[model samples]
Target chain A: MMRGESETYGSGMNEDKAQRLEAFEAEALGYADQLFRVALRLCRERGRAEDLVQETYLQAWRSFHRFELGTNLRAWLYRILFNVFNSGRRQEKLNLVPVEETISETIAWDPQTPQNIEDEDVLAALERVPRDYQIPVVLADVEDLSYREIADVLDVPIGTVMSRLHRGRKLLRSELTRYAQSAGYQT
Target chain B: MQVIDCRNYRELLDSYLSEELSVETNHAMLRHTEMCQGCRGEMAARRRLRAVLKRACSTDRLGAEAEQRLRDCLRRETAGGVAAIGWGRRLRRLFEVRGLFHLAAAVAVAAVITAGIGAWLYGAFDGPIARPDLALSPALFEQAAGDHEHCGLKFAVLSGPFEMPDSAVNYDPSYAGLEKVVAPAAAGLELRTVHLCGHKGRQFAHLVYAGEGSLISLLVTERDGKALDMDQIPTDDGIAAGMQTARRENLSIGAFQTTRHVVAVVSDLEAEKNRLMAERLATPLTEHLRRFEQQTAMLSRISFIGRR
Candidate 1:
């Protein structure tokens, strides 16, 4: 009877571990794509981006039991990604220059056009903007993050976020114009 | 009412487009855009540029991916009790680094205080005119002759005080020099006298020459309490006239306003050299106005040719 009780106790422990593992796996799978995209923007390389996302997942899994259920799951994931990016940024020691405003000075086009410039023009233009500008612009315009949310993610002051967004938009506008002109499109 | 330059309207355009401008300003921008071709064109262009950027740099898909990867990584690591224990230890260490954290926190606090003070002063003194570009007036062109009578380019005035920071007058800090910046219109017209007041209390004389086919202006600021000398005046012989009824640097002008006064000449100077010359003249005039303001302690003011 004592031997049988020991076997049951051991089996119970194993089942509890299994259930916890299954729950974590499900949550991790749900957040994989979001992690990958943010990592891609920061790293700017697909493989490295994927690896960063994978690392983030690993970190999340290790801390899963501690996570408060029903909290902002997305915000939590973003904070980790931002930390990873911040660490990488510090290591690289990026020194970025502020963008000038001349790029958007010309070309009077209307916003209400049915179909505007092509996608290739835009992608090509975005590649030219510096990483500092690229990150904020993408998060604000593409991801639709508010200025405050962006400040939280980037871990910078809201003013910095606003300035960066302004500078990035100006640079991108200039690049787009050049791209359009080169593509043989008229003013 | 005249239409101001579209360049000055850039800031307001952004605010208007963002829907961040006050209701009054928004109405002003809309009204101005409807009547002014240049402003309308600029607004259209800015909108287009923003749209182009949006389409070019969409990151919705990327954000989603990043979120997913983060969760995955965290889940996998936490599955192992070993990883959980390590993170718990790291958190404890973070708390232990109290001294270093306090130092960093203090610096951040100082920076925020400084920024806040700077922003507050700028807003309070500027009187809701922080950005000239964003101050585009919404009123449709108010003409003496009704809509059918083609009134030539209405003179839109962008005027303000010429305040001088001490640094500008002492040495020339890059920022201090703006104390002497002025936008004095010098096309050419006969007036008893034109009073161009800087924020500090500098004044100048101006004239508008509204010719049948051309609109010319000549502005003379005081030099040591006297009108500018003849050698400083820009005349028709020196300027090249064109069909848009425009001319470039129609005259070469040199005038000495008092130590507190600077003179500016604005004409239809399309030539690069003429524009530079005008800017040089206007910049000094801005300074003269600054000195005048310091002596008098009066706010910047503008006197219109016809009605206020």
Candidate 2:
């Protein structure tokens, strides 16, 4: 009788575990493609980007128990993605050297947005932006992440995120303007 | 609220566009943009730029093969019971089970604890557990050999005068002049073709050489985790310490890892000859890759500092 009872209890526990895993798969796996798109820009290689996404999902799954339901799961997953990406290069986190904030501050002129800009030109221009600023811009503009969400994802102050996004957009505009002038397109 | 000026409008424009401004500020922004055509136009232009960026980036999606691999990896993680559900909860669940299941659970938990202790004792957690003898998947060997057979030999048969395209630099700037780096090492080999090609869903900078009626393929691919059995442990010079050799059918492959890439030499030569040729090629290639890695790191660091 005790043996039968134990077997039933064990099966119940197994079923619960399976259900939890199934729930995780249903909720979390849907974001893989979106995460992969961002990962591609971050790693700059398809294979590494895929691996990064895989690692991100694995990390997310491991901590799935801590994740709150009905909250912004998308942002949480993105936060984990950035965490995985950043953790891999922990040694590169060197002492902060203060530098003049010249790039964003000096944009005295608002260049008119160019017309007929190829997608390739825009992507190449975005790639040229410094990564520190590029990430925020991509998060806000491309991924549609809010300033607060980007701040959480990047582990920086919200003010820093806003400033970086501002600077990154200005830089992107100038790059687009340069491309337009070179291509002889009327802006 | 204070009356908003042109400077304040410009400063608030991005926030307003992002819908991050408070209601009062948003109303002020609206009033200002309504009166000022310039701010409105700038707002429209910025919105257009954001839409363009989103459209461009959306074109890239996860490849089918990669998605399948991710699913497989997650399945394995689940099957292995590595979901990291806390031990306390697990123990509680174990106790919730009655007689025979309790014994079984205790035994399983004891075994896991023992294995963990043994692994810790062996210093397996010190870094990536390096299984030097079999450091890469057999599929990778087959993929390298397949690229050698299909890309190297078949292209050699076609015998088109192939020059590395300028667009290869878009994939990796190092690919533009890669032949120059490998040329000295390949003394007697006739350089047949060099191009960036994809095989079995992985991209490689493929350089084909012909010597003594045998075709050799030097492939450099990004080191995704599954490409090797262990996480790469780079030495002080930024290249993994030693060569890893594998054989697939008639082909012999010898590979090593730089910080970001895997460099392999695939040929139908005897194991010893292939190993020797791989060693010869590995030196210059590893050195070149190390320098490139350093330069990239330095450039990113400089950019980081500049941005901050």
Candidate 3:
């Protein structure tokens, strides 16, 4: 019943519109896996991550007209994902005061890189890092986003992204080193 | 090419791995790593760690059922033509004369229908009508009452074994010692539980109390966008004033706003009694929150000056 409008339009017009939507879907849906991976890290729950990804795609579809044809669609989708997540947690934004001071102090003591660590241990260490720092780390290290892109996704200055990444990596390294020591791995 | 030391190499390694450095810096890094075996080994370890993390995280794919659901939802949206007209064009068309008049008429009709339907739904034709002057969102009252009923009274509307405010320091630092602040005013009531809970996407530091065979919830949440309709009420030296009252169903909600938070007292008590309790509970809590606000303001101002 909702598709009644399609019958009203001529075949040529409907075909062209259908082609455009298909093109949009073809381009946008390809990144669902990547988006879901990042969403999982951000939400830390399967159901919430799936919902976040769905909401991101829906929002992206609604605003697809504004998106430039040749720009980075992946970054755009990520921006929308962060926007949805942040808006949902707007109340929590009040507590997001910069913890750079404490984090910077703690990161001064860099641990030696640990060896023979399991993949699970690495993930556990990454999870142990505080969320503010963990985001930049995942964006930069895991997702392979540049500092500029990470900054753009997070809506923070490039310098802030760099510092957060630096600190987050250090925290991860320390966690891994601690894990390695407990598991009797070489450091 | 410029010469580099271990310190520079160590500092730039992360950027180097992320491919953020310029060609010149990359060359310098390569030259240093070629010469310094220690830095090279560190680089290898860091790279290996990055790979392991990526591989571990990549294991979590969108489940097949979820993917199928997403496809179905998208198909429905496409069929419904929801995204055919862009929101910008729709918004622009809203200001057209005919569109504006039609919109106004529709809103008027909708308001009347909503008021009548709402009265019928609540079965409270004589219940407290929201004063137009106090432009608070009606949802705020419903959310507070719903939290009191579902969370405080265990109505099964929200999942439970909720966390205490002490454990919620990661969410909001002010929640760390909130019970101590309200203990003086809540002396008579038996404190049932103090926990951080959320209802309808809004987070609350909910402190439930029991007295006179009734359960009361003292909730504190960030105003976010749910601010009072009136001009800013002056807090005379950290003292809370202007307790706004509203009633929903059988519950009375008396609320006040600080610079950053909305504190409400919701219970089945009479409106006047709820208002009195709100004043008592919110005074100390308001003073406490105002201090946090002032500290935050001063910290930001100091940081602003430092940045300049």
TM-score for each prediction? 0.40, 0.53, 0.54
What's model 1's TM-score?
0.40
Better of 1 and 2 by lDDT: 2
Best by TM-score: 3
Candidate 2 residues A1-187, lDDT tens each? 2223323322223445556666887898888888998888777788778877887776676568788999999999998887666544344331122236764554565556675677888898898887777777888888888899887877777877877777778788888999889889877
The lowest-lDDT stretch of 10 consecutive residues in candidate 1 chain B is B139-148
Model 2: per-residue Cα lDDT over B1-308, one tens digit each: 75687777876777887899999999998898889987787778778878889999999999788878776665544433422233234334434454656466455445444544554465422223233322445556777888887668753432212345443455566566788898898899777666666566556778888786788889987654346433322222325336777777788888877766678899999888998998887679878877886776666556545755
Question: lDDT for every model?
Answer: 0.44, 0.69, 0.70
Clashing pairs in 2: B135-B229
Q: Candidate 1's residue-wise lDDT over B86-150, tens digit each?
A: 22233334345647656655654454345335544544212222222111111101111111011
Mark the 10 consecutive residues where model 3 chain A has the least summed lDDT. Answer: A88-97
Cα-lDDT of candidate 1: 0.44
TM-score of chain B of 3: 0.51
CA RMSD of each candidate after superposition: 30.7, 18.3, 15.2
Best by DockQ: 3
Ranking by TM-score: 3, 2, 1
